[model samples]
Target: MRKILTLVIIATLTLGYSSLNAQNYKFGHINSQELLNAMPDKDSAEAKIKKYAESLQEQIEQLQVEFNKKYQDYLQKRNTFTDAIREMKEKELSDMQQRAQEYQQVAEQDYQRFQAETMKPVIDKADAAIKKVAKENGFTYIFDTSSGVLLYFSDKSIDITPLVKKELGIKE
Candidate 1:
């Protein structure tokens, strides 16, 4: 009975020690924001969004010019207008101004949606590449330094930016 008890204890310690040794964690980190910025897809997406914004701005400017022209005309001829005409002109100007403001608000919202939609695939590609690199390289925990959520990481934390870039076929 004593010999069997000793054997059981030795077997338990050996298995426990081996399990502890097998729990070695490999930590890696990558700056995902920098990776996304470096992607060519992102550059194209930015250019497209910029062009859309410029077009929206041009439309806004046209609305402003139309408003200015009517306002100037109303100011010049206010005394010539009958009371009814004057009130109608003022209401038109007010409605035009309101429509322009609403248009601006809508344009702002559309721009935001456009930006997010255009950037989604680019972001997803970067994320997939990061994930592939992490899994292939046996990273137990891959932290995103770009998120700003990670306050500090020691020098030993691996920066896998190059690996992710390579995985994504990005030279830069």
Candidate 2:
């Protein structure tokens, strides 16, 4: 009776352990930044930003040139003019400088707003693609490896960065 009881106890423990092991979860990890970089539209987005920034810079340069021309003209006339005329010229130059600064600031702000607006949609699309891929692959959970927020994960976690990039329509 003692032998039978011992065998039964051992069998019960072994079955419990095997059952627990059988319930293993499949998970995946992705570096969101890596996926974003691999996106086909990434280069296009960067080009757009570059073009916008360059356009702003050109406008600012034009303003600077205009201001400089006015300033030099004012300086040239200052020595030959009366006190009232010189004062007027000085005020005009100061006002031009202020206007140029204001224009540059406004342009910079506009660029920032445009970037935020345009990139928001792209980011949302990428996020949706990640979710879809995770669902299709039967992933229990997906962690963002680039975010440095995951405290722990086993080696069994699938690195799905490339999969996400592919899902996002990245060819390379």
| Candidate 2 local lDDT, 29-116, one digit each (tens) | 9888877777767677878888999999999999999989988888787799999989988888889899999998899899998787
lDDT of 1 by residue, 7-75 (tens): 999999999999897667788999889998889999999999999999999999999999999999999
TM-score per candidate: 0.85, 0.75
Model 1 — which ten-residue stretch has the worst lDDT?
A: 19-28
Please report how far candidate 1 places residue 52 from its true position, in Å: 0.7
Task: Check candidate 2 and list the clashing pairs.
Answer: none
Name the top TM-score candidate.
Answer: 1
lDDT of 2 at 13: 100
| CA shift of 169, model 1, Å | 1.5
